[model samples]
Target: MSESLQTLQTGPSAAAPGDFGWHLGMVLRGYQFLFEEAVEGMPAGIRGYQILSTVLHRDPPNQQALGAHLAIDRTVLTYLLDALVDAGVVERVPAPSDRRARKIVATDNGREILAQYEERVATAESELLSGLKEPEADTLATLIARLAMDVHRSQPGSSPCEAMDHLP
Candidate 1:
């Protein structure tokens, strides 16, 4: 196993109740670390991959909707989209219903890169959760997805990705 994966499986030393946040921070860092190598060539690391994934999956109505889903600022999203466009991975198209509004779409190259990234990410995730049995891992995934959706619903206007960061 890779060193980072090993470290994550073993984890840091235990923490006191009051240090729960610290422990979670370490855990999140480990997860990010696992993806670091896989996303090395991508723009904005995981965030950029997320933007691509959102574009491919949700087919959101426009740039604003895309930003809302990812919880990225409008200006930041524009900057990121610019890079993706330059890379020939994505495009901003004229919205059919409104000339002023623009929609985001993935080009063929974007779709191919996204497909490759998704495969690598899936492998990394499976390794990250190697300690869990299949059923347990599935349960954890379900719970986390539900939690994120619930938070997103409760906090209107906040991106589901950012919603987790807002928890006390």
Candidate 2:
């Protein structure tokens, strides 16, 4: 028999398919797939939307900080920002405190698109969690955020985006 097929037949597998890390991975993948579809056709899809949202919600110190916070690499963030800057969705303006550093800010158009996308994405997320009761969903979100924050604190300087970096 083929090695791959043999492994699948004999290898350890999650007992419930909804247990532990495998279950988390499956859920996250589902959400990512749904979110990708949710943000389609809006300039670089989810990545661009995230960048725009970051700029809109927080005044990150500079491109580097934004990249770090988004868990995107500096080079990737630069490339992504190039399209956003060209499309006039965001601008890197010189920071008042530091001439060399530039802060990201969303333009009017970027904000508008982000607002629309936010509504759509929220609906998509709601639907994704539709199986859960409202309180369960809220508790889940809160717990997840708290867990992530704990991880961030424990693993200083690691990109949160790294969670999705290895997925197929």
lDDT agreement with native, every candidate: 0.83, 0.85
**Which window of 10 residues has the lowest lDDT sum in candidate 1?**
159-168
State how far residue 44 of model 1 sits from its true place (Å). Answer: 3.4
Q: Write the per-residue lDDT of candidate 1 for residues 83-109, one digit (tens) a residue.
A: 899888889999877879999899999
Deviation in Å, model 1, residue 125 alpha carbon = 0.6
**Which regions of candidate 1 deviate over 4 angstroms?**
1-20, 157-168
lDDT of 1: 0.83
TM per model?
0.81, 0.85
Q: Which candidate is the best by TM-score?
A: 2
lDDT of 2 by residue, 1-168 (tens): 887656656646615323557768888988988899889888877899999988878878888788888888888888899999988899889987798988888999998989999998998899889999999999999999999899888886877467787865
Give stretches of model 2 more than 4 Å off: 1-18
User: CA shift at 125, candidate 2, in angstroms?
Assistant: 0.5
